[model samples]
Target: MTNSKLLKLPSQRQLVDRLLHLIEFNHPFIFLSGKPGSGRGTLCESLLNGLPDTVRVVSLIGSAAMKMADVRQLLLQQVVARPLFNPQDALADSFFRMLDGKPANLLLLIERTDELPADLVGELWALCRHNDTLASPHKLAIIVCGNDVWCRSQKEALKGRAMPALELEVAPLSPPEQRIFLYEKAKELKIPTALLPKPKVEEILNGANGHPSAIMQSLEDIMTDRRPKKRQAELPVKKIAIVLALVVAGLLGLSYLPLFDGMGKEETREQPQEGALPAPIGSDALETNAASGAQASGSAVNGDQVARDWQSDAKTLPKKVESETVTTESTNYEGRRVVISDEVVEKLMTQPNVSGALPTEVVNELTGVSSAGATQKSAPATPSAAQHAQPSAPTAQAAPKAAVPVAVAAPKVALTPVSTLNKKPKNHYSIQLMGASNTQAVDSFVAEHALAGKVWVYKTRFRGSPWYVVVQGDYASSAQAKTAIRKLSPALLKGQPWPKSFAQIQKELKQ
Candidate 1:
């Protein structure tokens, strides 16, 4: 129906004109032959539209099961403009005789004569020839339309009976005519011309085989299935939500970065001293103690001045520690409590080696560690030791350290590999979807179609270059493969995929 207007193009105008002339001249009999869907009925309809008012037209469909009596009954019913309740066989003959006496011409249009029985067709032609020989005042013309089979049958009958009849054929559209027809249909459908690019148009043309009906169907399919291009402003809300979720997840991931840093650092344990401040927890606590020790050492060079300064600092340390200490039962590595009493302070002040910096032996006795780097700084400050140690005490109350190693296992989904397709029997078939120059293009195509892990891609040589071919499911036979093509998505269908035997695919794979 979409191609109805295309049947009247200039390429077919002459055929319509010829048929009209033959009908007007009262040709005894005319045979119109064409392949099914070549527009035979459409051409005859055009002729009927242009006929004169005086010509009476009666159209009938021929069938293999129809008898001459049935034909006569049908014709009589049309002539009388009423149903035949109980018509006699001779009634049709009487009607024809009555028509011969009138001045008006009678035209009979029979469609699908290929399905009519041989005897029935011959009888109809005999009636037309008899009417011609009678030279009646009213002329009669019979125009029959059929496929190539009907044309051959009629020709043989004519030779056998030495009958005269005009033979005309309705041909398929030529290549140029087909192109014109497609462009016209595309315009009628309001499809953009650019959508029908040269390669795509060529594919459609080849697939349709120049049939007007097929071409029109293909164009209509394109118009129906065309997808609108997505714009940034029109992005789906789901995708935006997913992106925001990922950003939140990334922020959460940063919290675990410190754990990895902790795993790589060497763990050292320090023994708590009697009447000393709590041991450090995190690196921040260690750095605070180091800074305080350095400041204390830079104050003076004489041991007496340092002891006077130290004594004043030592008296306030225990009070500060008592006020800030956050008590917890677990205090081994993460938190420590140590008190430095007046006895240790007096002992340190009495030593002559305790000058600008505390002696290394005294520093190690209090701090329980000795390093070349530590001897340069003054002993850890008495007041600040308790301040830094309290901040790290809360870390001991956190979840157990063993829980850090507990990780969630990633999920796994099973997928059939593409390479397994090669082991299939040679007789098995598959739909070849597309071919690409590189595997990335094939992967992109699969991912875009949401076909990843469902379809298969294999390498083959094409035009002497490495080519990747994507194929659909394996099928037992080519017919099954072809049927599966119809079930593919519209986007995949546009590529014009075809069925191929595994034998052929494997042969190419070997190359």
Candidate 2:
């Protein structure tokens, strides 16, 4: 219910989604609201464009006409199956039933409601109450769009309403969206300001302030002036050269001095001879050795350091060996221990030039494969293969699973592939994705398919409870339907599908 979707300006996807949500949920009212010049009307049109041809939008602009007679124009715009003969009849009720036999709902977008007097809004709200009628099975969602929230201001009139309106404010376009709009606008004009220097370009965008209307106005002025003024370069090359020369000469002069001679030369602090003085932790000359366990002359390092130092040396040990029993042990290659799988090693040994253990080329090739998809996953190969077997228990049991090949195939589907049957029988089939027959389910199916009335939800009650059944794609034959069902990515599907023909569905509807 909280439409907290961030919509990029000029891109109507989110706006369309929100409108679909309103329709699917049977939301009584939506004030197509926004700040002034936020492209509210344009957003409405964008949303309307995606709607099915069956869904009629009766646009009533409040500012354009005030008298009751002017609203008749809204009805005349659409091809009406039945026209109202009584002017005394309430506008909302007449609009609701005006759709006579429309399979889909009617969307009434009353624009510029801010211009309409508060009294007129009061009459409209009172009039909109009829939109929630159960008679005629008519669906009408009234949307009054304007810059201000009119209903909130007229709380007195909305007091007795059976259903309240949900206000959705269309925010101004974001900075990025504004930039895109400006660029596209400039493209239409064939100007180079859109690609102008950064500072100047940013200045132009900054002037727009993330508003579509402002972008059009500010971009015009900037586009007329194609280029930005270039500033002069000010690097002191001569001063830098003199500084570098002085520093180099000073370095050469210091190199000859005795003070610099002893610098950086390692002192050969010879270890104590057999019966000579020993350096201990208490001595001032004691120093640390990184590799061996000797922190001081004739003194061993702590046991931990001795272990770490030995581990480093062990990594450099040669791996080539004769008559080795371990076939799957990890090999220390290039200071990094690379796991050489027994299977890959066995395969390589079958080829020529593999007599001496495995050749370096073979090992590198095996390592490359081991790092790829082959070794990236382990869990899927086991469980996914098991799941596939479970789903088609009898068929899987009858066939022989090639061990390594089966494992490789299993990992691919372990996440989503599932290795289910790729083909199905062709028939007049429909995918029963969900159930609980109501307008809500139908709306959901519509939004999901964007197919409108071409595919629909059937309302039927089972066990004294209403069930809305969501189905899609009516195929001519069972095999065709099965193929269509297979096309549905297993990743997107929630559960096992029941693809049934219209004959099979008739029995369900009866039940």
Candidate 3:
């Protein structure tokens, strides 16, 4: 017996016992199957040694090249031990003659039966089917051993046959069987057990994944110190240094971001009109100027000289800072001396915080100039707001006087460009018109489309840039918003409006 037969693990031993039981009970056909490296052949050899001497054993190796004639010749040579002139008729004759008066059964072991030609395999199945018909005193048991391929083909061959074939499969080594196999393999190689610690043995068994051939190869590699050791993965030193440098540079750049934030607010401040006066600097200065202007209200002041002095001093002050620091009353001084009274100051104080160029009628009254004279002399230098309002005033004045109370009874509206959709349910849908990086562009779109109070504009970032999106919404669902697209003005429809859910907008806002 070789070392392979000597090392019969628990799984192999179980298969051997089952094979013996099937043969003892006179099973006509037996199909033994296993995968490669599962040690099925080794188990068969071990079973051969334990059988009695009276039993006859004929072993054959199956291959694709072997024909029926070749099989008969091989069988004759093994049974008769002499060359037969004609083995065709003697094939069955020899088998019956040997077992005619025998008290023992014959076991035919064909290994690697899956490699045989397709027709030859069919012939073998035919032979097993006629096992009971032979005129012999003892029975003949046919055992075909092969991998999973042969097992499937044999099953297909016996689908409707009356004869039954016993099938057995050899499984892989279990955890305990793997440990014993490794220890025995190491002993066979004359390697000391002390050299293979328990931890290394367990690792090798796991690495082999229950394959006996792999376990043997791994054991040989360890014996010769050819196995590579496991090492921790490491990054290149230059790559580590480069990554750290980039992180530090990014943090330093972020540290200077606040300085540029204030710069945008400075650039966005409105520039004063060309002939405007510089507003007084402090509250104390404004009180002093107001008292003097009040006394001059009763007398006629030189409006042209006052305008020249105001324009001359305006050049010395920063134009942008004057807008942020001045009150509503100071904004009225536009290269002219305006009458200042207690009642006028009180009314100005009571007005909402509004900032823009005054109407031409108001400017003409304060400067004490005829409408025709001011239009001809300073028409080019006049503020665009005052010029725009001049064409729309006649329409307002022509309305019936009774409409005044109706205007006062109307509800106040929010005209700011920022979206009111934030207060709505996040799941509600809206129609998106467009997006812009500047809020001014969003405001201009709303005004140009005549959708001042009908749309929402909200701030979000797009590809690392500040973005504002114009949307008309508060629809209960996306389908309703999509249906509302046709109701928009023709100018708005040209921008290709699309519907979006407010839940998505809220997510972008958080980012």
Clashing pairs in 3: none
lDDT of 3 by residue, 1-511 (tens): 1435334666677777777777767655778888876666776788787776767888898878887677777865766556544545535555556444545467888888788655545555555554456565355677888887769767666744466776787777888878888888888888887879889888888887776767888888977988788897886999999999999999999999999997887877765557756443332322336565454443332343222112234556565553322233444667554354443345456655536865443455456655455434433555575548586666554354323231112232233333555567987898999888876677667666677777766778899999888777678887899789989878888999998898888777766
Candidate 1 C-alpha lDDT tens digits along 1-511:
4325754577578887887787777455778888876777767777887788988887888878887667677776665565444444454355665454555577888898777655556666666655555555356677888887768677666633234776788777889888888888888888897789999899889987766777777887787875455665766889989999999999989989998777665342343446645333332322335566556545543323331123333544454454332334545666665555454566677896665886655666467564333332343555377447676666554334323342222332232454686698899998989988976677667767777667777777888999888887889998899899999889999999999898887788779
Worst 10 residues of 3 by lDDT: 404-413
Number of the candidate with higher lDDT, 2 or 3 = 3
Q: Provide the global lDDT of candidate 3 against the true structure.
A: 0.68
The C-alpha stretches of model 1 lying farther than 4 A from their native spots are 1-4, 63-69, 82-94, 98-100, 135-137, 159-163, 224-511
TM-score of each: 0.40, 0.37, 0.39
In TM-score terms, candidate 2 sits at 0.37
lDDT of each model, Cα atoms only?
A: 0.69, 0.58, 0.68
| Backbone-clash count (model 3) | 0
In candidate 1 the C-alpha lDDT for residue 71 amounts to: 69
Tell me the spans in candidate 3 whose CA falls farther than 4 Å from its real position. Answer: 1-8, 63-67, 83-104, 135-137, 159-162, 193-199, 224-511
Q: Which pairs of residues clash in candidate 1, taking residues 3 or more apart in a chain or in different chains?
A: 275-339, 275-340, 276-338, 276-339, 276-340
For residues 1-511, write the lDDT of model 2, one tens digit per residue: 0111223444446666878777756746666666666667666666666677766777766764465555544544463655754555555556546555554467767778677645556556655565445455455666778765554554434655566667777776777776667677767666675456678668867865665666665556665754466887988999999999999999999878875555534343343447534333343223335533343334443422222222233556568665533444346544554455565567665776555586544554566643332432423567567667577666554344333332121111011111111122233577776664455545644455454544445555677887666666767777876777778756426555667776656555565
User: How far off is residue 451 in model 1, in Å?
Assistant: 86
